[model samples]
Target: MEKSIIIGLDIGTTSVKAVAFSRGGRVIGEQEIAYPLSTPFPGWAEQDPLEIEAATITVIRNLIQLPTIDEKNILAIGLSTAMHSLICMAENGEPLSPSITWADGRASLQANRLRVEHNHIYDLTGTPIHPMSPLVKLIWMKENNYLPYQQASYFVSIKEFILYRWFGCQSVDYAVASATGLLDLHHLKWNKEALELAGVSEAQLFKPVSPTEVLVDLDKTIADQIGLPVHIPFVIGSSDGPLANIGLGAINPGEVAITIGTSGAIRQIVTEPKSDSLQQTFCYGITESLSLIGGPTNNGGIVLQWLKETLDIKETYEELISVAEKAEPGAEGLLFLPYLNGERAPIWNANVRASLFGLSLRHKKEHIVRAGLEGVIYSVFHVGQALERLAGKPTTLLASGGFGRSPLWLQITADVFNQEVQVPISHQSSAWGAAWMALFAIGEVTDLASIKQAIPMQENYMPNPDHHKIYMDLFKLYQELSHTTHSIYMK
Candidate 1:
């Protein structure tokens, strides 16, 4: 008997993952491969787009090639990629340059100039003007490294690279387009000013499409290598973060998004073409019915990963969390500013560096470690405040990402935000979201209300008043130090 399976490929900043599942969303096989981010210069982080392409291809090929997997029954392939990171390829679809990752800060100056001149990078792209945006990265290339955009053909996000490998087209899912900071957040199309600044034409960008649209025609070249026959179907999927929200059942309005990965973002779902008056938050459409509005911070699990290496803290995450549990709430007044890769969202400074405040002789290694973790989680709360303010109130916070596995992290997140947070029993809500999107496209589900009922909830963490008060004090101190430090650093 042939077994049919659907595949979701999540191409992330620090790693690439492909998970195979049955239509009911039962996982059968999975593969995760980490890749290095080359930093040839300071304030710069890049990766060979071809390398990412090859890795995705390799994983998918090996995945479907495994024995006991019936090749003929494979249903569809959907992709979810890290947003903003872009590849500039030649006319023939060959990569002409390394892709600038969403974390790269070399383009901070370009973003700043745009903010000053345009008066509303926020209005144009829903996202604040920041170095993390692909538009800024592209502009940086033209002003600082001009030849690439002038000579190269297309400037695209990671999924376009994957689509080219699979079906030989440069199409983008709306989720991915929104992240580029080039798409008109309200209208869901590329901004003319963004294109002019990038020195590229509309032809160089992905033909924006919906998440549910099947846009790939299995090219024989890729099909033969992956053990799948030619003419198979592929969907130009959406951004990993937004899809994670869908997979987590956080798609509906009033749902706050909290994701901790290589980077983190806290956003809320809205139904209207909403904009944050603070000019601090960005907006993007999830679908005609749902809009993704939130602020994203540049640091998350990366800070934890840094602590693990810096303190020679070779202990596993669980062990580390146990240690963190023993530490006093608020890390005993210690504060860590997570700007190691610069910052985004509310604080738009890119030249700023990471630091620890209130570090003293009394602080132990555990205290230092605990402060780093809490600081990163607390930073999300800052964004959360802006989101809630925009919506006139807070919403049900849904937490996902690799970091959500830690109970301590979840508790701190809830306490810091002073709201209850939910976690899914099954992980990778992005993939789950993609599958649910597939179901929606096929007419299985009409709206998110049904998805809410269908998706299972694992657990919820409520805020502890005592702990919340402690974090409130710490967060106030955090905001003070963050603003003072950012102003000084930028100056």
Candidate 2:
């Protein structure tokens, strides 16, 4: 008898990954393939959907062929993808345009206009008014008469496009659709008002389905190529942000999940749908009854990467973090506003650029680096503050992402948030969440709560009282600087 395995396919911005996991919550095999994000013009971030589709197929094939895995024993495959990727397609499944990623800012002007004129849209959709939303992107396309937009037979997300290519259906999960700024969060359907605003109709959009929806009978040729049975179940998992909460076992009330991969977010699951009044957070659906309300930051480990490359520093991430640790908790009064790639949540401004304030002769290279790192944490903390106002304080902070590999970073997060931070043994939260969704869909898992017991945990980081005090004091100054500088960035 062979061990049963579940596969989770994650379609990310810069890469596609497939991880095979056993029913007992252990990784069996994994494969990853990287792709490039193209910048044809300033503020325009796009990717070739064909390349991503090919990369996804290749990763799945590679994972199934791993020596430790037998394709026949694979019980199911679940999908988890980045949110807010828009692709225009022809009727024959050919892409009419490159996939516009969430990072794309070509729609900034449209977003700004809507944000000022139709602020109520954010209240209804639960998505912030920003260029990242496909709603704004559609407005840009309509106004500019983008060739692809005019010729498109359908407008779909990258995940929906993949599903159409594989299963011959055009469907999108609730979570992914909700992030598009076009879904009615309260009713769990397309918003008529949003369609009118975007100048499109419900006919042009994919049918929204539940995340647990299962599809069978894969394409015969592709199934044979990937060595999977034609009838294997494929679970339509939720987007990465909500799924990361499940992967980290943060489902219980008041358990906040903080992830800092290329980007960062602070999310908590709620029993009911709720949007922020101040528009400081977004409310995306996970299930019919459960929604995720949180703030996402455009800056995270990517900020550190930018610092390393721009400074031309040859040090490894570990070494760089070590240098950052040399500076005190507050970085000796130096402040950094990390809006290098614009910002989301807390600010929701795409025009804003990065800034280093309070820089003086006293600050050195180490201080600058430390401020950068601390700045990222402070920004995330700012989001947490907004979350606290709406959802109450988090009982536990479950940290997952590239930053978790650094103990100093983990400690900083704990101190800055003034709470205990728990790291999962597995950093692949989204993939693991997708695998768990597959298991649940196929009756391999009895309940969602069972995942908490199966997932292994690491030691918790407790905040240092002295450091927390310092961060609290400095946070006031950070807030003041943030508020005062908002106008300057708008200009």
Candidate 3:
């Protein structure tokens, strides 16, 4: 008796991963292929699309070849890609420029300009006026007369480019399109004014499709390269953010998903399109009837990495965290503003820099390490605050990502947000969500709600009563210091 398996392919900023899962939601095998993100100039983060495509094919091939994986029993493969990657494409499907990722800040000037005059677009599209938005990126290209922009026949995301190369079609899932700042959330189509604003037309973008849309008949060459049948169906899963919520089984009412990887986000599923008046959050479509409202922070685990390197700490991450756990809450009045990588959501400013305030001679290596970790979770809490403002308070806070591996990190998150945080047995939420989407697309699963039952969970991290009060008081100082720092950049 062969076990049925499905593979989920995640196209992330710096790597591509394929995870094989059994029908029961247990992992069968997995493989990951890494690539480099080139920064030719300041504020420019780009990747060679062709190189990424090679990695993608290699990762899938390697995953299928794992001893535990029976390619013959493979049912389907689904996609979950990071959002806001823009690539200029030629008429013949070749890339005119490298894929500009979400971290690129080259469009900060243009984004700031648009933020003043055309702010209404945020209400219409549900994406903030940030450099991460492809629309803002396009505006920068158009204004500066970038050569690639002039030569491009079409604009597409990395996922769409891969699909075009494999399937010879220019198609984008609704969730990725909504993050572009060019899709009409209410109408679920490319916005005419947004196109006119970016100096591109509807003809220049990929045809928007539902996330559950099935793409079949993989290119025969690619199919042979991966040793899979050409007719195997591929479900067009949503962006990593929305799919992560599904992966963590956080779609039920009052459940919010918080993921902290290299970056972080806090998202909640909503019945209809919702946007905050302050433009603090984005609403990306998941299905025709459902959407995800959330905010993303550019800083997360990267801040801790930066701190560890700056202090010349040679200890492993686990050891450093163990030392940090010794420090009491508040780190004895040492607070850090984790804007080392600029910022997104709530602030929407890319010029803001990092700062360590309230530093005193009493602070030691452990205190600094603890404050650094606290600062990272505080950044997540900052985004969660904006999420709450838009979608109201969450009853359950679900935590995922690299930070979740540390009990101290989860406890800090639970304390700062003053909510119980549930950790899933598997940290591969995006990949799992993509696998579930493949099941739903093939009619093997009844509905999205059924995934909640398949996922295994551990005991919840409850908020500490004593620590919560200290954090709340310290959070006010964090809020004040954040505003002061942002004001300096804005002025």
Candidate 4:
């Protein structure tokens, strides 16, 4: 008997991953292709849209060619993408500007202005006024007279641009659109007020659709290039954050999903649209009836990467982690704030710099490494606290991402948050979530809720009361230091 399979294509910040899953939630085949992120100027991050699109095609084609994958048994392909990428395109579908990713802060000045002038914008869109938002990016473009902003006939995300290439239509899933700061959370449509503020019209935006919306009849020329069937069904899966929650069975209230890869976030699913009173968290729409509330941290495993390169460490990643494990908890009174790449959530400030507080002559290389890990986990804990305020305390945490692979990191996260953390056996939670959504869309699965039983889980980490107590005090000091230095770093 031939086995059936579903493909989940995840467009992440660092790489594009194509995963093939069996009906039993087993990964049969997978491929990943990394792409480069360009920083033309300090604080500005961009990527070539065509390069990402090519990477996407390469991964899918490579997956199809795998000996374990049978094309005839392929059911559907679902997409999972990083949120808050903006692209300007000409009417003929050519990109007029480089893709501005979520990490880009060229519009910091504009974002700060919006935060003061349009405080109500957060309440309406459920997205914070940040340079990461397309709304702010558009305003910056308009004010600076970016050629693409003026000549472009339409504005869309990388996902929509790819969809336009594949299906010849500019369609955006609700989850992706919600992160743009231009969608009305209540109405599930483009907000006229936001458009006016952005100096753009609804006509420039893609049509917003549900996550499970399916598109058939692939573009023949492109289909042949990628070795996909012309009539294969494509499901427009939601953003990576919400899909990661779904993949980990963290969709219910009180179940929080935490991911730490190139970046970090702590999110919970709610039945209605909501935001933090202080605008500390983002509440992006998942479905008409479901919203994702959470905070994102700019620092994650990437901080460790920076450390490894900057320190000229020659050891493998596992070896470096072993070095960190040698240092005792709290790094012997050395506290690190993991804001090397600015910050988000709890403060929403991007101008703050990372600091190593309480550093003494006793601190060594291992201590610095250990402090870096603690700092990253502590940042998540900080964000998690804000989420706890808005959504009540999270009863469960479903963990995913590169950081989750580290037993030490996982334990640190659990201990810092003072909560039990569960990791899925499959690390590709975002891709799995997208695959499950594909299954539901094609009627292969009965409902989204049934996915819980289908997913396999690994060991759980319980917070040690002793460790939690110590972390609580250290976190308080971290908070004080952040507040004390805030005025010094404001750009």
Candidate 5:
């Protein structure tokens, strides 16, 4: 008899990935389809929804066509999508505008005004009042009278758009809706006040559902396009951040999940919905009874990528990291504030740019590279500090994403946080989490906790007290520099 398999489809910012896993949580096959981002104007990041849908179809089709996998034994496909993308849809179900990605800052002015006028929004919705949010994006559209916004019959996220295409019905999972700055975290419904503020109505939004909700009987056309059975169950998984916690087995209190790819976030699962009093962190509902709170940083490995390109470093990323490893902690008094893409969490300012402080003739290329790495880690550490206030100081660090693949970066992160970091053996944490959710939805898995026991753990990194001491001092300096120069960047 053939083994049953589950597929996880991750619709990310840069690509669409499909991972097939056995019922026992082992990966069987995987495929990824990369797509390009469009920037027609400065600070405006967009992607063609049609292109993304095509890539999604390609990935799913590729996964189903793998010779090693038996299509008959495939049980379900679960979804995990990047949050905060908005798209305007016409009455006929076609997108009227490009999908505005989370990185887009075209609504900065509106977001600034909302931040001042509607400061209570963060508490109500558990999403920061930032231009990246769909609430702010809608406000911008209403103010600017964008052509698509004027003629659209509805507003939806990229995930909803894709689901509508495949399922012929629009729906958003709880976690995705919570990131929109429009959902009431406590009530688990669209906040009327937020709707009025954004000049939108609840009718324009998709119905919110739980992550484990299953959608069966795929649209015949979509099924034929993907070469899959129409009756395969499609589980609507939660957003990447919350699902990543499940992927890394960080569902318990005092266990934090840190994912650093192009961007980074530090998140933990909590029992109830709660937001930071200072609005330094975002709290989104993962399920009716559980919430995921964390801070996201716009700067992460991207800063390192920018440094390598700017310095014309021809070596591989591994080689660059090796060179950076040569530099001692603190990078000889040179500090870098990694706000290359502005920032989120703690300081949710989009106007700020990257800054290098305490630079002198003493600093060399290796020192600069090392400082850059330290800067990103420091930014995450800053957010972690804020998180510690709420989550009670994470006892375990479950690390994932591109940065987790590097031993040097892992050690630096562990040392900076003064906590032991555990990396998962499977790098596709989000996808696996989605797959596990599908298993639960289909009753193949007994409960969510079983996922934790099934996932394989990799190497563990322990903190060095000596390095932690140095980082503590440098972090203080970093904070001082950020506060003192905060006003300068706004100009």
Candidate 6:
């Protein structure tokens, strides 16, 4: 029998990565292609769509060229993309403008206007009003400079744009649409009320499909160029955040995952369609039976990266965590507010900037590093508290991604959140989760729980009772600092 291969492509902030898994699910090939984020202005972040598309092509071609995997047996390709990027294009699928990332805060005024003027946008889109969201960004564009958008035949996300190039299809997944802040979560379609208010129409958009089902076939020209079989099947996938939950085995209600990658998020799956009464976060459909009611924060691994570069600490993250561990709990007095790109969830404030309060001559790099990790963990704790409040109880934390590589940070998170966290023995949950869904989609996996047998346990870190008490007091201080510093962020 010939072996089968499945490839999962993750379009991320820094680069496009592709991973190939064999029929037995062994990782056979992997590659990453770097790309730059265009920042023409202080708060604006954009990317040329053609450059991203070309990078994707190059990475996939590079992956298939690896000697280990036979290219022809590649059965399916699953796409997992960064959520909430807005792209405008012409009728012929040419880009009208650079894609605006979810981190772009140019639309703060638009978001404020919508939130103040119209009270029910949250009830419809579940996503909170923030400049980082695609909806507000679109509003800012239309109201400020309508010429570009007026010329745009279609406005879609990064994933949909890739699909249009690959399959010549003009559609996106419901899971993607759910995060766009324009789709009414309950209706599973675009919010016409928002459209009417924004001076756009549903007719000017693309179709939203299920993340698990195959939508269209890859074009022969593109497939042959990448060494895959022409007309191979491909399925649209959920956002990287929701997929991270699946990848980490956080598939059921109240089973949550905190991922710290280039970005950070706190997500949990819910069985019923639920919204935060406080409008703190967004809900996305993981599958028809399961829904993801969680908050995504813009701060996390990025903060650590910035700290490393700024401090000129050339050590790997492992060494950095070691440095952080040696520092006293609470970093003594320093509190680093990680808002390098702006923040989301719990405190959806994009006007904020990164600041270190309580910095003193007594503190050193170790203190700041420790405080940065604690800061991110505390931020994750805030999301957990928000989810707990909405869901009526606490959820288990199953962590994944770059932070998953560090033992000290994991223990710190446990102590800070006062919850035991499970670290899966298997890495690459994103790729594995996508592979599991593909298998389920094709009927190879009979039940979702059956795959749990394959998931190996790594280490479970318990909260330190002694440290927890100390951090509780510091958390109160942290909370106070957060509230006190909000007004001064832009300054």
TM-score of every prediction relative to native: 0.94, 0.98, 0.98, 0.98, 0.98, 0.95
Give the Cα error of residue 268 in candidate 4, in Å.
Answer: 0.4
Which parts of model 3 have CA positions greater than 4 angstroms off? Answer: 1-3
Candidate 2: deviation at residue 263, Å? 0.8
Model 4: how far residue 433 lies from native, Å: 0.7
Most accurate candidate by lDDT: 4
Cα lDDT of model 4 by residue, 126-233, tens digit:
999989999999999999999999999999999999999889877899999999999999988999889999999999998999998999999998899899889899
Weakest lDDT window of 10 consecutive positions for candidate 5: 482-491
Alpha carbon lDDT of residue 205, candidate 6?
A: 79
Minimum summed lDDT over a 10-residue window in model 6 is located at: 447-456
lDDT of each: 0.78, 0.90, 0.90, 0.91, 0.89, 0.79
Stretches of candidate 4 above 4 Å error? Answer: 1-3
Badly placed stretches (over 4 Å) of model 5 are none
Q: How many collisions between residues are there in candidate 1?
A: 4
Predicted candidate 3 versus true structure: per-residue lDDT over 289-357, tens digit per residue: 999998899988888789789989898999988988889988988998889889997788898999888
lDDT of 6 by residue, 124-188 (tens): 77778888778888889888875768798888888888888778887777777877777877868
lDDT of 5 at 29: 95
**What lDDT score is found at residue 330 in candidate 6?**
85
What TM-score should be assigned to candidate 3?
0.98
Q: Local error of candidate 1 at 215, Å? A: 2.8
Q: Which parts of model 1 have CA positions greater than 4 angstroms off?
A: 1-4, 65-69, 442-449
